[model samples]
Target: MKRICILVIVLYVSMTLCGCFGPGISDYRYDLATGYQLICSSAHEIKVVPKSSVGIPMIPAKVVEIVFDDTFILAKQLGLKKESENSTYMIPDEKVIRYWIINAKENKIYGPFENDEFNKKQKELKISDSLKLKDVDSYKKSK
Candidate 1:
């Protein structure tokens, strides 16, 4: 009876231990390779909101690499007003624009255009209480 009990306990322990080595997400995924789906935990998805001098243009984007990935990122914006005198188009009906990226979570800026004054109104936005970035070496030692 004692041997039987020990065997049952050992089998239960082994079964639990075997599950620990099951499938787990790696740091990165290579979808192009092996022709199989890959999921990664470390890889993060980000989006950029491009801007133009005239205003925000309609463009489709998929991915972007952030220079710095920190919880607390600061965003500075500027507003532009277009004036047309005598229909001469002082600002030109179509003016050149520059593009910049916005966070994926930030969708208000890309929500929709109410009127021509969309880009004319600029505001400052920031994300606080985010985990600041640290070098790889420093991160390993961090608690």
Candidate 2:
């Protein structure tokens, strides 16, 4: 009995040390109904409907990844290792008629919407509180 108890304690310690469980977990990448490929806190449950929302800028509604940090000064200093001279080309900011991701951060989305975080064409919508939002995953799978 003594040997068995010691062995169990050792095993438990080993398992704990090996991260059998703890708060050192981070899920920074997961897909969402909006198709944004969210890299947000999975601990927070995303709602089928957002109470309020914001807009995306630059790129088209469905397009991902817009805007390049083409610092002209950096290019001039480093002589641009292999970047194209026109690669950093930027257009003047216009009306918020589109939505796009801001580089690899992914969640920094921007788009035109009257009230929700997602767009109808980009995601399924359900009528609620005078607005619409992406359908929940469970709800979407059934259809």
Candidate 3:
């Protein structure tokens, strides 16, 4: 009995020291219509859904990064439709227009905004450089 207990304790300590008992860190990339984003987190995985298709069953593309970063969010807002969807005629639903970003520290979202206003805000934030889209194809193919 004593030997068995010792063995179990040793195994537990080894596993804990090796980080087997803790959530492991992961790196993710997101692909958006405008560009790609990269995220590092310990969460199981990131999820992305088209703003138009929320709550509806759809195969979400394996996106790499969060879309709520300055550039991608602005792009989404600029693309929002003016009309609403009706049962008889499917007008694009403006309510579904949104962009979101999630990470260990922040869960930020951006809703629709006018083009000129959004541009001005981005410039003021000094995040315009971060908005430039990366070579998504290289990352996608490397994966």
Tell me how far candidate 3 lies from the true structure as C-alpha RMSD in angstroms.
Answer: 13.7
lDDT of 2 by residue, 1-143 (tens): 99999999999999879764533354333333332333222323221111124442122212212212211000000011213556653232333333322322232433333223433423442213222222122222210
lDDT of 3 by residue, 1-79 (tens): 9999999999999977877544343444444333233322233223343435344221122222222342333233112
How high is each candidate's TM-score?
A: 0.23, 0.27, 0.29
The runs of at least 3 residues in candidate 1 whose Cα sits more than 4 Å from the true structure, single-residue gaps closed, are: 24-30, 33-37, 40-143
Clashing pairs in 1: 49-102, 52-97, 53-97, 71-130
Query: Mind giving the per-residue lDDT tens digits that candidate 1 earns over 27-107?
Result: 332221111212222222112223223343222221211122321122212222245544532231222322232332332
Could you tell me which residue pairs clash in candidate 2? 55-110, 55-111, 56-110, 56-111
Q: Report the error of model 2 at residue 91, Å.
A: 38
What is the full ranking by TM-score, best candidate first?
3, 2, 1
Q: Please report, in order, the local distance difference test score of every candidate based on alpha carbons.
A: 0.30, 0.30, 0.38
For model 1, state the Cα shift of residue 44 in Å.
9.7
C-alpha displacement of 116 in model 2, angstroms?
Answer: 7.6
How are the candidates ranked when ordered by lDDT, highest leading?
Answer: 3, 1, 2
